[model samples]
Target: MSGESAPRATVGSESLERAFGGTAACNACGARVAEYRVVALFLHETAAIRAYCARCYPAAADGDYHAGGDGLRLDYAAFAARFGAPGPPPPPTTPVDRMLAALVADPALRLLAPGSEAVARRRRRVPYPVRVGFALDGATSEARMSVAPDGRMTDLAGDPAACDRVRALLAGI
Candidate 1:
């Protein structure tokens, strides 16, 4: 989405002032953002601050607003092609993959490059498929890995630590 904040949307002056200091996630993509625009609040109590990047706040049709490198703006297809798209359902996973996934998920894991898109995209593709299992909220989650030509993740079993982390970083949607 566009890096610029939204233009005037007719929010109250007080509301805008409050938003200046607070932070909120983008309603369109869930990326953490500063409260720049207040839409509506629940039960007429609080301001339901719904701020989005310039691109997402305006042209986005659904929630999946994709921004480009400059964070300028983009349509869905272009976003998907440049940045890896979310994967579809896959088959079962293996024990090794599961462990790796957990390590990947760990906040302490230092495997992936820090704030490196080239590394993130390049490393996503595995020469061979890997699988992993995980537990969340007392439920079992599995993750599978698939490689692609652009070195992006083609498919993954959910909750796989590496898959989840990288996906979250890359997409942020």
Candidate 2:
């Protein structure tokens, strides 16, 4: 197995059909495939996620599986450049982000919050609003964190304890 490679399924083959579909394409080569592992450099609201094929992906790279997108081929080197050694992950969510996700999903939360604009602002203020929403239900809220375009937590509600806790959590990161 050291020198051998995993068999490549044809684009329309059944094996490929079963495994692939939503996988992201390689950032550099644009190979839409499911064979590569995903290498994500955790970013704030989003992840600099990339996929690498067994051949194109780094054999020694570590991270999650690569799901393809568009028609991009996996590019292991480029992915490594971005993710490298990701800084500490985001903090756990406040009670607010969690509630909003559930509400967004059920449509009831959006209806009940003060107003659409207010709710939106709260979402922006919350940690990892896009990913860790309802998933981190009771995750210490104190550790909940988010990343903004400027690469820092833009807002944390500033309720003393919450602000201090997150500030400490994101200190050098």
Candidate 3:
């Protein structure tokens, strides 16, 4: 799958009818198809979701059939990359960066004090607000995690145990 060949994401014979309502070109075949696979990864989200007709679909490269679902598993390599990346995401430039990296690396994310969960400025007398949230890849409304000048961490609504854990993870940042 790597010998100077890479499949570009595209759909042949695409049209408005197929995209919105009528016939859309199938991903595997150029024929105008209306139905897309429940798990198809279309080149374009606005277009049909990389659906194939009854004939083209149902074929699995790994030949593994999933129960109660039709999505052919993509991202085998992506899965490998995620797990294969040694250590953590990388060192951060800011307190929030360290906090985020730690959180993402920690598979056992949960509330330490009673709920769920960075940074430096051990010298600064003023506390600064750091926003945290669930969404990683996109922008989200973040809950505040403040850092007291003397190195006191406040996660969410000032959960002490959670702060301690987060602090341990983000030490020396």
Candidate 4:
């Protein structure tokens, strides 16, 4: 590696330090270093080395670079070819969809179709039903929701944890 262009140490040195015990953040995304996270170190034509989190590294790979030397070179096309194109974005979520996703986030919970007879039968066998039914409506503030086995429409608007998880997931999208 060129002493001036590349670091005397190998790539990911900071990430390694942070992973072991030190604290470091990705220069690109500002994400804290973590053991499971992948960080890429890029040496630019200006002789500046930058660190990026996995999500931001792909974009960085496309930047301009100098000729290959010191075992460091940025090949945008090759890098993109090595990693296939990203998939299409997820479909947008409506309020009812968010509500349903939150309701079913629990492993034991199930979303059942409305007026399903199996829901009634399952309710009869257990004190508490594990299923929930919902009707999606773009006009409503929240989906019309009902607990299984009882089949009574109720509101989960007061559920903070469920609402939080749903909001977090939506925000990530």
Considering every candidate listed, which one attains the maximal lDDT?
A: 1
Q: CA lDDT of each candidate?
A: 0.34, 0.33, 0.32, 0.30
Taking all chains together, each candidate's TM-score versus the true structure is 0.23, 0.24, 0.26, 0.21
Instruction: For candidate 3, list the clashing residue pairs, or say none.
Output: 18-23, 18-24, 42-50, 111-115, 111-116
| lDDT (C-alpha) at residue 145 in model 1 | 62
lDDT of 1 by residue, 95-162 (tens): 22232333333333322111122222334544434443334445544455653424345566656554
Q: What is the overall TM-score of model 4 with all chains considered together?
A: 0.21
lDDT of 3 by residue, 1-173 (tens): 11011112222234311333454444334456566432222111011123345665554111111112111222323322422321233231343333443543332332111011111222232454543333223322223466553445664443444444455566744
Worst 10 residues of 3 by lDDT: 110-119
Tens digits of per-residue lDDT for model 2, 1-173: 01111223322222322333556465335576665554332222222334455565553132222222322222233323432323333444344333322233321110112111123344455333322111123332222334442334444452354445444433523
Judge candidate 3 against the unseen true structure and give its global Cα lDDT, from 0 to 1. 0.32
**Candidate 2 overall lDDT versus native:** 0.33
Worst 10 residues of 4 by lDDT: 64-73
Better of 2 and 3 by TM-score: 3
TM-score of 2: 0.24
